[model samples]
Target: MIKQPSIVIIDYGVGNTQSVANAIKFLGYKNVKISCDFNDIENADALILPGVGAFEEAIQNIKKRNLVEILNYQVLDLKKPILGICVGMQLLATYSEENGKHEGLNWIKGEVKKLNLSREFSVPHVGWNDVIIKSKDPLFTKNTDLSNFYFDHSFYFDCYDEQNVIAYCDYDIKVTAAVQKGNIFGVQFHPEKSHNNGLKMFRDFINSIS
Candidate 1:
């Protein structure tokens, strides 16, 4: 039997951990678990932060779970492979203005803000959109030519390092779709909900560590 990589999907009472777990399992990874323990976050090979909800509440949950410090050590200090999806991606940034104003994990220098469309566009951008890959990252390998992936969100990350932006999808304005700085990575879209291409993307993410 293949020695499956061990991955931890953090659950702090936020969004779908099962779906993310299911995606990793779909990738043929055998040893995947949902961890509420902060120590599990520290000990895991890779970490996935998946969230759906307001910024403040999510941050509060992270803090309340006592996972902030260990996650910082694992992600920032250890430089382990880390992936954040949707609001989980936003949490990696410096700050957010979603519900009032709040601070993020600051692992990456960026801010999360509500999507300001041209009035005609919808507030929450849902469905499929083509993502333009800006850099040659392993996660987006041959992703530009493939069909569009799934997306559903109101806020996006405003990153300081433009070079870290690996991909972008057209919304109200062209926003940061995927950001990668060293071992830390974040995606605004949900690869699990994005069909086959997304499954490939998730599989790539699972096997990204070199």
Candidate 2:
């Protein structure tokens, strides 16, 4: 039997690390852990950067923990696949306009900006919404329904290059739902909260890692 890869949920003093870990555990992947230690992060087969907070706060925490360099090395140099969720996904952009101009990991070429919508639409685009898949990325399979992924955020990733965006959600304006750049990947929605579709995403991500 092929051994399952060791997946690490990065705990950089921010994000819904526990909930993400729980979701992964629920999928029966026993070789998983939540840690901020550089050694553990470096040793993991794949990484999950999950967040549920302000963009500035998340980036600050990541830098405070001194994770920026290590993460860059792992994902960029080693080509290890990493998934950034919500604000975690926003962290992948070049910078964010939240609170102030803050620097991000810049793993994907993009900028984070607040949603510009009319009074009819809400600020934080909460609840379930469907995504329009733009690519044949393995994370989002064909058979799986592309609707009803949980989303809760006011800011969205604005890709500098449209090719980086794999999926989009229409909310007055086109909101980037998912992005992929070689081994790096990110999702604006929380798959952990999206029921079976979410679980399938986690499963697909795990399977995609070689």
Candidate 3:
């Protein structure tokens, strides 16, 4: 029998790690864990970085846990598949302009900037929005219902290279909903909270790793 890949949800003290874990477990993936320990991260076959806060705070929390080096080794050096959610997605950028200029993981070439929408559209960009698939990436292949992913964010990833963007949504202006660079992937929406549509996305992510 084939062994199930161990999936580690990096707990950097910035996201709903438990919720993400529950979702993964619900999908029947038994070898899932939430940890910040270097060994757990290094030994995992895949990683999930979930966040629900400011870019600066998230990055700082990750630094405090001494995860930068290990994460770099696993992601950049080993090329393990990773998925970043919401603010977690923003952390993969080159930098962010939220509050003040802050550096990110630089995994993908981009910057995080506030949604520059007019007064009518709101800033946080909460609730369900339709996703327009831009690339034929494997992570989005199984699902066709891309219209109702939950999103709660004030900022969005502004990828410098257009080729890296896999999907997008409209929030007054074009908001980047998803991105991918080699094995690195990110989504501005909260798939764990997005119900069935979100669950399918998790399944897709797991299948990609398999």
Candidate 4:
């Protein structure tokens, strides 16, 4: 039998960590570990970075736990697949303008900026919105499956490469909702809170080995 991949949720102590772990468990992943240990993270089958807070605080917590170098080495050097969720996704960018300028993990070529929607919409585009799929990815087999998902953020990703944007959501203007760059992947929406749509995406992350 093929061995189950050991997925580790990088817990830097700043968000809904358990919900992601619980979601993975609900998906029937038996080897999921929520830890910050270098070995655990470095040796895992896949790494998940889940967060829900300020960009500065999130990066600070990850630094406080000494996960920067380990993540860089494992994810960049070793080329292990890494997935970032919500604020966790923003943390993967080059920098963020949330509360002053803060550097991020710099995994993807992007920057985090506050929502600048027109009068037609409001900031923190919360609620279920359409996730328009731009390209065919491992998670999305059909465009119909990329319907509505939950979102609760004021800032969105401004990807340097338009091709990197796998899926997006419309909020008066096009907003970066999901991004994929080689072994690195990020989702601006909350998959754990998105019910089945979220669960389906989570499985794509867990099983996405490259």
- Stretches off by above 4 angstroms in model 1 are none
User: TM-score, each model?
Assistant: 0.95, 0.97, 0.97, 0.95
Per-residue alpha-carbon lDDT of model 3 for 49-151, expressed as tens digits? 9999889999999999889998999999999999999999999999999999999999999989988888899878989998888774577776673556999
Q: Where is model 3 poorest over a 10-residue stretch in terms of lDDT?
A: 136-145
- lDDT by residue for model 1 (57-172), tens: 99999999888888878877888898999999999999999878899999889889889889888989888888888774578774655358888888999998887788888776
lDDT of model 2, residue 37? 92
**Clashing residue pair totals per candidate (backbone < 3 A):** 0, 0, 0, 0
Candidate scoring better on TM-score of 1 and 3: 3
Task: Tell me the spans in candidate 3 whose CA falls farther than 4 Å from its real position.
Answer: none
lDDT of 1: 0.85
Write candidate 4's Cα lDDT for 1-210 as tens digits. Answer: 878898999989998889989998998888989899888987898888899978999999989988899999998998898888999999989999998999998888889999987887877789998898886576554336347889999998999999889999889888988898888888899989988888888877766664
Write candidate 2's Cα lDDT for 1-210 as tens digits: 889899999998888999999999999999999998999998999999999989988998998899989998999999999999999899999999998899999989889999989899999899999888887568887324466699999999999999999888889999999999988889999999998888988888998999
RMSD to native, candidate 1: 1.4
